[model samples]
Target: MEVLSHFVRVSISEYFRNLPVPDSFVGFARLTGTEWLTLLPFVGTVSLLIYVTIQAFKAKPVPEDTKVNRKIQKESSKVVNMVDIEDLGDKVSYCRCWRSKKFPLCDGSHTKHNEETGDNVGPLVLKRKGAA
Candidate 1:
């Protein structure tokens, strides 16, 4: 192990010394300050356009009856589920993550949102009103 480590270290040093690094930034030095200044607005405009297009696509309409909506968030780590209980006694368990402590039911465990960073939405609970 010692011999192998020494050989690897010596080989790496010799390789770098034999083929020294060149001034890779020479290409940038060729461009004047005006060139970079001109490029700044182009880059900013392109970035803004991309951001707007993505945001427009992200806000696409969701149906009233759909149970799950996907690709709504930037990071999209959490799921937004709208469970439909057709019958009076039917049970619905909206599990954002299967790691819920409440098993099939959501115990607010998804608040952590899979440890991802972004805006998150929780499950939707719909209850119809009946006249007594």
Candidate 2:
């Protein structure tokens, strides 16, 4: 067992000593301008990846309800409008502010509401699939 271990150690040392060392493996201080330029993109890519990973980990997740309810007001009126999908156009902007003279449809009345209450309320636009 002692003879085998010594032989293995000697073989490993010989193999490592015979391996060729790359010229670029020299210290960073010895790197030439061209070598620095060649390494720039790799360094930049690695830095960008690290930055993005950190940002992703640090980011706070936003709630879906908050996104859906943004700038929407709660009204006492629980009126629901029934409209035929076929009757609607390819693109439709429905009233969300409930201030529309054309109830259930947008007539750009939210602009006045926004101006009066300093609220940024807008229409809920619906679009049909395959309708550019």
Candidate 3:
């Protein structure tokens, strides 16, 4: 994107003055009509990208969520139980403890959750025989 943007800013369109472009860096010439037509796809892709980028910068941001919007979002959010942890057996009477500060089994609370998306609960089962 940066390279293409730079090319556009530099106005490289004049390079197409004739089909047999004499750009020093690349010696591409004597290309057939099909070869030239193949370039159109790349040109169209780059043009669309540039156009969309310009539009993105020019377009104003949408209005902030109003109280009503917030309420709706909150209500809709209640249905998300994406991290529902299943039963991890008993907590006590087993005579085992979690290595993590979270204690008990684990929600991976002790593990670094830099990229983990779910609840930081671990899969480690606390090996205990008594109440946790």
Cand. 2 Cα-lDDT? 0.75
TM of each candidate vs. truth: 0.25, 0.40, 0.24
> Candidate 3, residues 60-131: lDDT per residue as tens digits?
877673122222234554522232234445541211213333333244433453244333433534443674
Please report the TM-score between candidate 3 and the true structure. 0.24
Candidate 3 off by > 4 Å? 1-31, 59-132
Ranking by lDDT: 2, 1, 3
Best of the two (1, 3) by TM-score: 1
Positional deviation of 59 in candidate 1, in angstroms?
A: 31
Instruction: Spell out the clash pairs found in candidate 1.
Output: none
By TM-score, the candidates rank as 2, 1, 3
The 10-residue segment of model 1 with minimum total lDDT is 65-74
Per-residue lDDT over 15-38 for candidate 1, one digit per residue giving the tens place of the 0 to 100 score: 446542335777666666766675
Off by over 4 Å in 2: 1-77
User: What count of clashes does model 1 give?
Assistant: 0
Number of clashes recorded per candidate: 0, 0, 20
